[model samples]
Target: MSHLPAVTLNNGVAIPQVGFGVFQIPDAETQATVSTALEIGYRSIDTAAVYGNETGVGRAVAASGLLRDELFVTTKLWITDLGRTSARDALHASLDRLALDRVDLYLIHWPAPATDAYLEAWQGLEELYAEGLTRAIGVSNFLPEHLDRVVALGGTVPAVNQIELHPALRNRETAAAGAAHGVATEAWSPLAQGGALLAEAPVVAAARAHGVTPAQVVLRWHLQQGHIVIPKSATPSRIAANLDVFGFELTAAESAAIDALDRDGRIGPHPATFHG
Candidate 1:
């Protein structure tokens, strides 16, 4: 293949390796950002009901004139919608908002392990998966303890587990658990916010050698490690750069050089501590 290769999920679903993520994208800007992304060869579009941009995302994707089957759209259920009935309703509502028959993948926005309802909520996910409302079901920000409960409830092994992953905070232990359980790890923040990683001597050298931007080198590192990454950008230039990671390969040493940057730096909220 000339570009990034999709990884087969536990259920044999082929998820695009490099997808566009719309986490902090505002509802007003989603259409333009997504339209730009689709025009740049991005087939996978990731959004969440919690992101409040689902409607805009759907609008842009629908307006793109791409066949629904040709595009892979993924969304998540908010923690508030964690009950069986609520989760099921959330699935349909998400579909309606996204203007799709069924999402390629659906995920629980967060485990919210503190609640008494996660196990109760899982049944809803299972039901939706069975009904094909969601092509696959998974959880995000779930730790090993949470995964144990999910398995104990006789829940379907998640096809994917979206988590905060970057050069820092690699989540090595969690990655092993996911692999042992046949769940794939998807990186939400593959690029750290700080310019530090891109400015590092090693990364700069690698980018120079490949004649690409530092961001491409960082994304290239994520790919070589067998991690699925969704790096987001609204600017046309960065959006195009994020998608141009297919042509080059990173050497083992180059990959390791980036790996050395891992210091367990976590920039986002810890799911365990998040109140919502």
Candidate 2:
């Protein structure tokens, strides 16, 4: 059985704290990689329509031989599908691609404020949740301003706000805002796209001190902070190593050391102006 801990959403659905992400994995490699993750005890899997690998993800899930309820699959609505009618239709298409009747979580991929349609798109998500197309609904890459507007616009308070978060890019304000509104914060790019961030002094030191890999140290830091993290890897050893993080602990000073590494070090697009 998977030993990963679970966090309950506002809507009462429990999601695994650590998940596998399929952001840039090629469509050809997605099925095998995702199957590896599932075998390694990852219950949550994060993907998106724009990633162009939903079909591969579906194939892997179909072949896993696990029950439908055993997995928590999450996908997003791309910027192009931001209207009530289009967003609703897009979800049906994503469901078709995923080969599932309903997804565990479906989110507005980006605020795409330039289009001025996220609010309308959120309405679409509400309709999807009510119609039972998804078990839970949320948003991604949303800042406080965007989240506040969603709350003010009035509907189901988003159950989650997936954002770009890592030790080098703490994003405390957005995380705090989500907490203020009872929205669970999920971390994407949780390891800062790997490589450079993992080799940093603090991360390396923590790994040495804890007898773990630098990636595990970083992921453990995210877990200790109560943020859901989805770290992706195609290598079998790395994928298995990422899940071996639950056995250790970091002290308050050690956690703070990593937290202090935030240098506005966001490697992804900024939420305020990124429309795509």
Model 1 alpha-carbon miss at residue 81, Å: 1.2
Q: TM-score each candidate.
A: 0.96, 0.98
Backbone clashes for every candidate come to: 0, 0
- Residue-level lDDT of model 1, residues 5-72, one tens digit each, is 79889998788899999989999999999999999889899999999999999999989998877788
Can you tell me which runs of candidate 2 are displaced by over 4 Å? Answer: none
> Which pairs of residues collide in model 1?
none
Question: Per-residue alpha-carbon lDDT of model 2 for 180-251, expressed as tens digits?
Answer: 999999999999964888888888898999899999999999999999989898999999998889899998
- What is the Å distance of residue 55 in model 1 from its true position? 0.4
User: What is the alpha-carbon lDDT of model 1 when measured against the actual structure?
Assistant: 0.87
> Which 10 consecutive positions of candidate 1 have the poorest summed lDDT?
1-10
lDDT of each model, Cα atoms only? 0.87, 0.92
User: What TM-score does candidate 2 reach?
Assistant: 0.98
